[model samples]
Target: MGQDAFMEPFSNLFCDLQCKIYFLLVGVCSALKLTVPPHTIHGIEGQPLHLTVNYNFNTTASEVQIIWLFERPQTNPKYLLGSVNQTVVPDLEYQHKFTLIPPNASLMINPLHISDEGNYIVKVNVRGNGTIAASQKIQVAVDVPVTKPIVHTEPSSGVVEYVGNMTLKCTVGKGTRVVYQWMKNGKRLHAGPNYTFSSNNATLLILPVVKEDIGNYSCLVSNPVSAMESEIIVPTIYYGPYGLRVKSDKGLKIGAVFTVDIGEAILFDCSADSNPPNTYSWIQRADNTTHVIKYGPHLEVLSDKVAQKTIDYMCRAFNNVTGKRDETHFTVIVTSVGLEKLAQKGKSLSSLAVITGISLLLILVMAFLFLWKRYQPYKVIQQKLQSRPETDYRKAQTFAGHESASDDFGIYEFVAIPDLAGGSRVSSQSVPGSDFISGQDMLSTVYEVIQHIPAQQQQDHQQ
Candidate 1:
């Protein structure tokens, strides 16, 4: 309880200290204060300008005074105007230009000029219990509005690429404290190896102009009050004939070689990328000699009319203005591929006809073979067997004559058996020699030999 009592006095002291600090802040908030919304402002020449100020004070004032003063850099301040309650007073030198009202603390200047640009001070004073004074400062800038800019190029006739120089100058009719900038194709441009600018950026110079330097250019001029851009200007530059090439309407191209069908008429076009369009010439090389054949961009060649099967051709592009030239070479070959294609079509049809004819012949041969195999062989064998008996009987009769005794000299065996019922005697006896044989016996023996021949032997003999 004693400790708590001791701490209560310290708490009261802390609260009293907080109350004093709060009251001090309240006194500061109620003091006379002056404020200018913008610390700096820009104005155009020959225009009206206003310096606004706000002020408030808690003390009751019997009189209120507002005074305005102007000062330049490193110069003493000069009185411009003042107001007491509702009455206004201005300096005799600037009485008609400066205006003010009492308790307003604001000042106005009509017909602002470049010489009138400076710092302005507004002071507000209240007098009753004591004088409460507050002041604020404002910076003013005056500029002449920029007019439309004009750009002029040197040697407007034109320039040759890589052989000429160019210059561009920017000008404004009426402007003060102005700045200049250069634009190319609507984008800001900077210094480059080939491009330079004047100290004020009002002039641009191109050293040894090139093809890349050709573009739309403009100049932009501005001041604190106004800004303007000049009309777009394009500089003419003459360049060479580039990327020379040749193209044909009907041909098979491989690199620089063109293969055209025989008897075909092909049209070739020579072209190049150039500024002023190029003049073309066609040259043909044959038999170790070259000569210009045509003087235009197009040439028609008949494959059959060309003397040589393979030929060399050239397309020359010339730029008259720049005195530059470029050329490309190509080869043309006359071929029979189209005729061969037609022949191949005919051969394919002929081959199909031949194959069909051969197939029909093979079918006929197979049918003939089937007929021969089924009926012809049997008739032929029957005819041959029917004639076999007559042929063998005649052969046996001839052998019986023994025209050459040497042929019948070999040893022989003969057997005879009689038929019991027919009364024919069978002889199991050896025959006499050829010299002693009888005619009847010979005849019978021959008949017997013919009857004894094997059936297989007769078939073999017939075959």
Candidate 2:
């Protein structure tokens, strides 16, 4: 039983090893599929290049034959390099340039140049279990790197729109198999009525430079290996002072007439669509004549300063480069909400008020003086005399006459004269038949005035 047990383990070990070998064969068979990825390759000039292939076989091969061929359009395949088993055979012409490794089919080209660009064919034949064949073709391209290009314009000076011709040329520093394309304002440009191109599309000719041709232009240069673009340039073209008009900052503008308040200031701006900015001049027209009022793009008009309330004005815009000028005429109207008139009226009222105030003050002063003169001078004396006892009554006699009181109130005049020696003299004058009291009668009446009663009582006392 012990001997059988030892032999059983060894038998099982042998069975497992056979099974592993069976799976290994199956994996090797699956790997036999040949693969050649990226059948096309690009290479730079004066640079080394490579092309590769992959293949496998389940069992060891007695002989492996690899052959490489070169072909172009409408041409038979030409031999390049090959290997059989372990020996390498290369064409004498390209032996030093192209390298071929056996079993692993990969090619290397030293110092690739522009002339080595074409289709390449690689074939590998496996001799195990019958002759098995596999082949792949790869396309190769060689190119010199593109350099920065420059653009030159004919007639670099300013060209008038629709009158002059212009041409643009693109040149590269160094490149191989380069193609050129034109771009305007960041978009691809094509031939049109005014645009023509050279044979290689490297030069662009504009028969007539229009206003639309004034834009940014550039050239795009490209090759299989690299691409480059030229610097953007803007061509000069002179345009007109088009779409000219006038606008104001402050006013009621209808069509061309501007209405402004009497004392208001308004600013007028003149503008136009032009290549070069226009120089503006403001002109005032009066009595069928015109004169320049200001010289600038902006004009400030004060309504009060202008003599004519309603006037005609013009704004002229001239382009120095294009030699073109445009003029627009407008009427400026002054409307009366009567603010200025109201101000004048207010001034008159103020003057009249001042005069009336002065007159009133003078009249009041004169009235006060008249009242004081007529009564104030006698009141103090009368009061003092009345304060005394009746002892003065015999000296003062009272007269109760109605006609005496009526005759005392009247207008009196005073005159000033120069004396004979230039001394000043003042005299009082009263007409003889005037309704006024005489000096002596005034004294007597004043003495009796303190004892005044009613008029009827005075009349009765007289009777």
Best by lDDT: 1
Cα lDDT of model 1 overall? 0.77
- Residue-level lDDT of model 1, residues 94-137, one tens digit each, is 89999886667778889899999999877766676655565677
The regions of model 2 sitting more than 4 angstroms off are 1-40, 55-60, 70-80, 89-96, 128-137, 338-463
Q: Candidate 1, after superposition: displacement of residue 412 in Å? A: 42
Off by over 4 Å in 1: 1-30, 73-76, 339-463
Per-candidate TM equals 0.66, 0.60
lDDT of each: 0.77, 0.75
Worst 10 residues of 1 by lDDT: 431-440
lDDT of 2 by residue, 1-463 (tens): 2354335334444544544564466543332456775756889999999887887766667788887777778865677777999699888888899897676798898989877889887776666654455567799988889899999988888688877888999999889889999999999999999999999999999988888898999999998789999999898888878998999877677799888888888889998888878888999899999999899989898889889889899999898987889999999888767444345335335778889999999999999999997787467555656575552332222232324444443323333345788655545553332233333334344444334434554445456
- Positional deviation of residue 77's Cα in model 1 after best superposition, in angstroms: 3.5
What's the CA error at residue 274 for candidate 1, in Å?
2.4
